[model samples]
Target chain A: MSEKVLMKGNEALAEAAIAAGCKHFFGYPITPQNELTAHMSKRLPKIGGTYLQAESEVAAINMVLGASAAGVRAMTSSSSPGISLKSEGLSYLAGSDLPAVIVNVQRAGPGLGGIQPSQADYWQATRAAGHGDFKLLVFAPSTVQEMVDLTGDAFALGDKYRMPAIMLSDGILGQMMEPVVMPKDSIARIPERPWAACGHGDKREHNVINSLYIEPPVLEAVIKARFEKYRLIEEKEQRCEEYLTDDADIVIVAYGASARISRSAVNAARKEGIKAGLIRPITLWPFPTKAIISRIGNAKTFLCVEMSMGQMVDDVRLIVNGKRDVRFFGRTGGMVPTPAEVLGELKKIKGGI
Target chain B: MLTIVCGHYGSGKTNFAINYALDKAKEGKRVMLADMDIVNPYFTSSEYSGILISNGVKIISPTFATTNVDVPSLPASFHSIFETNDEVVIDAGGDDVGATALGRFSKKVKEKGYEMLYVTNMYRPFTSNADDSVEMLRSIERTCGLKATAVVNNSHLKGLTNASTIIDSLEYAKDVARSAGLPLLFSVVPRSLIDQLPKDEYFYQADVYVGTIWEKGED
Candidate 1:
């Protein structure tokens, strides 16, 4: 039987990681995300797992790389600047095809922006996290429950594809306390990893995990093979949460905290006699572009609401392909656009004035 | 003059405080800059340690003693420096922890007759509206047990920042300051966009004019 428990997104993530058999966690503390490190610090030791508050984000991510190379489930987390430091390590992980989980409890930034929640990292997470010809599986969780469930999925996908999986979260999600139903024990047995480096003796060949491919052609082949795996991920793992879309004239596209606020906007719009709906992307990297395109022919307009200045709007425009008028409503630097504010934007788009 | 710069993350608080410390040092004042941000790894005032030190600004940071910079303990000397220095600037961590830490030093600061500025970037989270800004200020006050002396309206969107966005942000910040019973200290604008803004905007509100100094010199 599933039981409901009150949890923060960070705690949910830690629990989910443990449930997924993740045994190593290396991170630096940052506000709106300290709870994650705190939770792991307490829980990991109990389960005989490893948790280390690395000296810096650079050190933390490199530690994750070490743990991953050693064939174990490993994870790391930070905010914007810390995430920025981890980007280089992420690129290395992707190049080497090593599986690991990286959580960015995104805060406002181009620099040390703020500690308040911001979905500004949509571009950073969905695009290459660093300078490279590679991609990471980026997942966006809207609810605390999804934070728990998707983290498990991230580990499985990371191991299956032999690449990095990132949980793109924000301060609001990390700090907000909510009720979530923890997964049953029976549901946790799937996706066992045998490829992990727990040490193989003379029974097998030595495995050296490195991103260095000196020859250009061989590197090109490795990249091509990684792309093939990404294609499979895209095909099999495009996740989205659609709300009140049937018979709606307008659709609001958002993810994470913005999605929660957008839900309220949809409800507010419906009360005002506007048929507005919401489509929330669960996976940001394997963006549900096809799902959006499929509905574009029917919806009259689409509104992209985010905490950043039109980052995800670009993706909406790409999917709509001029099929419908696309509008944008956003708040940046950790400011949450209220439900009423989003409803106001919907009213403008729906000609309800 | 003791100045404590407080703001949310990415609000340019560190940049402003660092420059202010540098400006004071240029005037030959014995300036001590204490970085209380154990949160952000990049772009803190202490990140420019070399330049600040070379320019005769004393720098105190989490990395000052500990190899583990993420969760560094504040030194006991941090409190005494405020009493000794002619002008000391405290750059607190972002949000809750920063506010809480700054609050702990409030009595010492009050004793020293220091000025605390609550920096607000109108484009930032929880500060976009007057109500939200007021709420954040109240929370900060609750955490620190001291009210902010002034409000700094330093608003901008990273990369896509423009003059109009700054104006819109300032408009909201003006309302926030008025409601919170604090004077508007200044509005921070990028050096490139500064030319586009009307002089009147700064004439009425700003006590100081500033620019981004992160890329200015060798750190």
Candidate 2:
């Protein structure tokens, strides 16, 4: 067994990236995610990895683009507003089909949000991480250990599909400290892709990496092929955790920090004789539709809990498709709902019946 | 096993609190890792709550303690610590300013007669010498109205760290304890370096919790 070490969420994510063989890091210093940047800055040079604290989120993401194009494991991190600035580069990365990792330690926002934890970027991460007809595999880690585990996996998955893996962690997950066990052997096995923008060196035809195609038919084909890859990812990469749902009547659906809070609520509600269970989506993008749909038969009602204004609940509502009554409870503007508050929500849901 | 862990910022108080709680819980003790860190919003015990719950440890914090607000949200529930008989581990916020919140419960806490542990990393700024370390403890004790019964040696420079830093801090830990007339409870050493150090010393084999990424990879 690997000895477990205590680590903050952001630090764990950075360490896991290094473990995954990521050798280049480019990021701007932002609240909540500073630990990750600081950690990389302190350690990357010693390990012969490149760490650059870019001038802006724009420069940082573009730096990742340049490194990833050369077929190197690279990443960039920022918060909500910073992510907004990196959107153009994010779209570019997707267009070029370059593999890398992007971390968004989400804070409250529509415009410069507070420096505390918030999951308000759910829609932005899942629906439109970048402006284009593309999808990034979004992983929502609820614990520090998950942050470490999924971060390593993020690189491998990004490499597998030749696209970026978006880790949507909020401030709560970014700042908290916990005992974490790094994987025994987690160096990502990156296969050399022929499409990589590396030196041809007089061997075969020159390979090009670009997202744009001026020819209408060529662009349509490129977009169609990207969708095909996304389709496969959705089918194979969906992950979630189900707790005490075997005999549940009312099920609570949540993700990330909200899921951890809801876990406490579920345990408390069960003691109160309320058959409440929880469904925590590990992968937010490929939305665990089948998982929730399977539980709809045993559950009479579903309560969607989030730290945002009912963003993920919309995805749940779509999966339920009017089969069962779906109720929503959310707290926005950087306010995290306590476990007692979540339990109270469950109690209210119980009373409505 | 109710221990109040207090220290200056970057002193590794939160890390020590987590390791101690997990150790007690693994020993079959029902642990309560309470988060009284109402001041610093960046790092706190509330984040490890999920893993702690899995280990059968209960966590008690303010309604929105980890939420994005500067408001001191601690409620009257601070008195609930006296109600639990489990191994209660209190993770106080950094410095005297943060430890002042503990004063509200000091009366009941004193009546219960618990041990207050002052954690120190001699390598951190302003805490490298004995006088500075003792002064930090005195201020925290005055603010919380509680005397520290022991000191934990948690000194390291992270990536540049090795067994020598921890060994060197043992003398610093003893000096602070000697000045405060307290016991040198235990020195924290990374588990990997444990074999190289003398086992005769009072030590807790610590995980490399506060180190950088290059310092990671040991299982």
Candidate 3:
């Protein structure tokens, strides 16, 4: 067994990225996620990797795009508002079909929101980040161990699919410390990108990496092709964790830090014989619709718990399709909902059921 | 007893200070925990103000702590800690940048004759080795304007810390203490891992407080 060491969520993600063969990290300083950048700055130079603090989030993301186009695994991380500044670059990455990792250790948002943990960026991440039609492979990690595990997966999967992947974490998880067992062999197998802009030196035809397709029909064809890849991802990469949902009456749909709180609430409800279960969406972009659809048979009510003002509840409601009562219970503006409050919400739903 | 804890970031200084304060409070000594950590906005000792206050432990946190603000503002002056006849535990911030706040109280603390304990967790980023740990201590001492009197080996991997983990870090901790020319005070062992070790006065058994929201029951 590998030795388990305690690590904060942000630092663990940085280590996992390095282990996944990510040699280039360009990021701007932001709360909660700054530790990841700090860790990268400390560790990357010793291993002959590149760690750069770009002037702003925009520059950091473009740097990631440049490195990824050069066929190197690159990453950039920021908080909610910082992510907003990088959204245009995100669209460009998707349009160019480049592989990279983008991490958002989400803070409370709208405009210059509080620095506390919040899941308010669900809409921005899943639906529309930039001004175009593209999807980012989004992963939500509830624990520090999961943060370590998914960071490696994010790099690999993003490279495999040729798209940017976002690790949608929150401030609570970013700042919290937990024990994580690292991968036994830190070295990872980096896949070869055939269409990279890295110089071939007359070995083969020069490959061009660009997102500017001015012709409308050509752009539509390109977008449609990308959609085909996204369809495959939606089919294959929808991941979630189901706890006690096999025979549950109330299914709580949550992701990231809210899921951690919901898990405790589910246990408390189970102790009180409320038959509450939890479906934690590990991949937020794919949205884990299969997990919710399968549980709709036995689950009488679906409670969508979030740190936002019911952003993810829309997804849950759409997935449930009015078959079951979809309710939302959230505490936004940096206020975290306690397990007791969530358990109380479960009991009220149970009583109604 | 004026015990000021300082260390690198994530070195478990806050955990050690809390347990030390609680231990002294339980011993019927008047304890005052000054949460002087101004760097980190999260996971500070000020978050446990209710529990600390209820346990008869007077707590003084930085201004705007536990609020929505991230500004590192200390009190204009500290009077209660100097005035009271209580066993004081000042949890200083991490690294030299965080420890700069401690310089404000240098003269008063020096006159009071205090033991500045430099906490070291070997698993942390910068202080994983003796040289780095010693450099960190010297830098902290320079910024804080006080000399550390002893070394605290609070080395553990949070919840994954086993008896072997602590035992293996013995020489590393001793090396840190020796390199710093400070006496090795004691190694902190969590309450669960106490039985695995042979009883010795060098072990300080402590309950792991100051944890995540999910790990509430463990503390």
Candidate 4:
């Protein structure tokens, strides 16, 4: 195993991508995530990788699409508003059936809200990433180590599924530093991409990658086929971490930074003799419904904690399906909820519900 | 002493500067910390101005220091760094780009006889070796137009740091100082691990004050 070294979440993700055989990075500078881009720009050139600061987020995502279409591991990163500019490109990538990695190190949103950490982009990531019928494999990492781990997974899974994957990180996770043992830089077994549009060479048939479908049935069939992949991913890739939830009365559902706070809250609740537990979702898109459903029998109440205005609570309620009372507590617009606040909310649910 | 802290990004310079200022203040000396990092918007010393001021350390930060604004303008009171007799610590930004902001005040800083401390964490990406670390220090000096007086071996992986981590970095840090032709002033160790290591005048035991939101109170 490699020695543990301290690294910021952004730089860790960049290094993880490189270790996973990502050699192309096109991005525009944005706060909270500038370090990731800066790291790539400084390191990639020395390793003979391509790192370009595109004119804008739109240009960057399109450049990623172009590089990924050529069967290279390419990625782009941005903050909230910049991710918004990449939405059109995201939809195009989905429709074109291309594999790429997109990083959204979220800050407060709506319209250039603030630079502070925020989970407000949860809905943008999970439900409606762009104007299209598609779903991105969204991984929310709470720590710098997890950021490094999940980034490799994001690239591999995106390639395996032949669709774009989103690493939904927030400002807190992006800027904070922690001890991380980077994955060893071994030879990445890059899978053969026969369907890529890298020059035909006259030996085989030409490959065309496009999102535009002029015929209705053809587009319908393509989208339905994409949904089948989503279903398979939903069944197979649902991942989460359950903390002390085996025999608890209250189950707190959270992800990313909120999950870190919720874990502490659960611990505090247990110290007070309150039977509380936490279910932290590692994949936000898969939703980890199995973890929540399994606890529904023993858990009496479900408390959802988030850094947004209860965007993820909707999914929690949808999964609970009226089997139990699903309550939500969130602090929006760049405010983070303390463990005490979450514990208070847990106590409220324990006492009343 | 007027101390200026400069280093590559993610080298723990901000934490070192904060610890140095607070320690000076604890000795009942008037200390001031100037947050002159215009390149980075996150994790600057100005964010902890409240605690620093409460501990009796004066602060002067760039304009829109803690806000969402991304301007590079310094505060109007930045000239006070030269005006005051208080022992001042200027937390310069990372790399040559970050240190470029400090270049504007280079003449005054040199005239006042500043002890520029080049902080280094070999575990970081760019400065992972003595050669690379020395090159970075030289670049920072070129950009800031000032010479470093000493080298500070602040080598550790934040909370995961152990005695081995420090011991392992000793030679690398020494090489950095030796190659740069500067004296190894001191090495920073977490206060919790003080007993496990040998006592020395060159060891500055520091409490980890800068941390993420969840990891804050735990430290």
Worst ten-residue run, lDDT, model 2 chain B?
B210-219
Interface-residue RMSD per candidate? 18.1, 10.8, 3.1, 2.6
* Tens-place lDDT digits, model 4, residues B20-84: 99999999999999998888767889988988999999999998887877677898899988989
Output DockQ, candidate 3.
0.48
DockQ order of candidates, top first: 4, 3, 2, 1
- List TM-scores of chain B, every candidate: 0.85, 0.92, 0.95, 0.96
Worst 10 residues of 2 chain A by lDDT: A1-10
TM-score per prediction, in order, is 0.63, 0.70, 0.95, 0.97
The sequence of per-residue lDDT tens digits that candidate 4 reaches over residues A1-353 is 12777788999999999999999999999987999999899889999999999999999999999999998999999999999999999999999989999999999878989888899998999978899799999999988999999999998898899989999999889988888888877946678888899987798988899999999999999899999999999999999999999989999999998999888888888989999989999999888999999999999999999988888999989999999999999998888899889989988887885
Q: Give the runs in model 1 whose Cα sits over 4 Å from its true position.
A: A184-187, A190-198, B1-219
Segments in model 2 whose C-alpha atoms lie over 4 Å from true places: A184-186, B1-40, B43-219
User: In terms of docking quality, how is candidate 1 classified?
Assistant: incorrect
Candidate 1: tens digits of C-alpha lDDT, residues B1-219: 778888765466777787778878888899899888766534456657877899898888764432222444677767666668468888877666567767777787778787878887665534667787777777877887777899888765544456787766767778989988999877877667777787877622222222122112111
* Residue pairs whose backbone atoms clash in candidate 2: A2-B219, A3-B219
Predicted model with the maximum DockQ = 4
On residues A1-353, what C-alpha lDDT tens digit does candidate 1 reach at each position? 11344455777888888888887999998866887897799789988999999999989999999998887889998888789989899999887788899999988887887776788888889895988789899999987778988998999888888889999998777764455666653455435546555676767766677889899999999888888888888888898989998878999999988888888888878888999989999998899987798778678999999999989899889888887889999998666688878889999988842
Candidate 1 chain A weakest lDDT stretch, 10 residues: A1-10
- For model 3, which pairs clash? none
Q: What is the C-alpha RMSD of each candidate to the true structure, in Å?
A: 15.6, 11.2, 2.1, 1.5
Better model by TM-score: candidate 3 vs candidate 4: 4
Candidate 2, B41: how far from true, in Å?
3.8
TM-score of 2: 0.70
Model 3, residue A183: C-alpha shift (Å)? 2.9
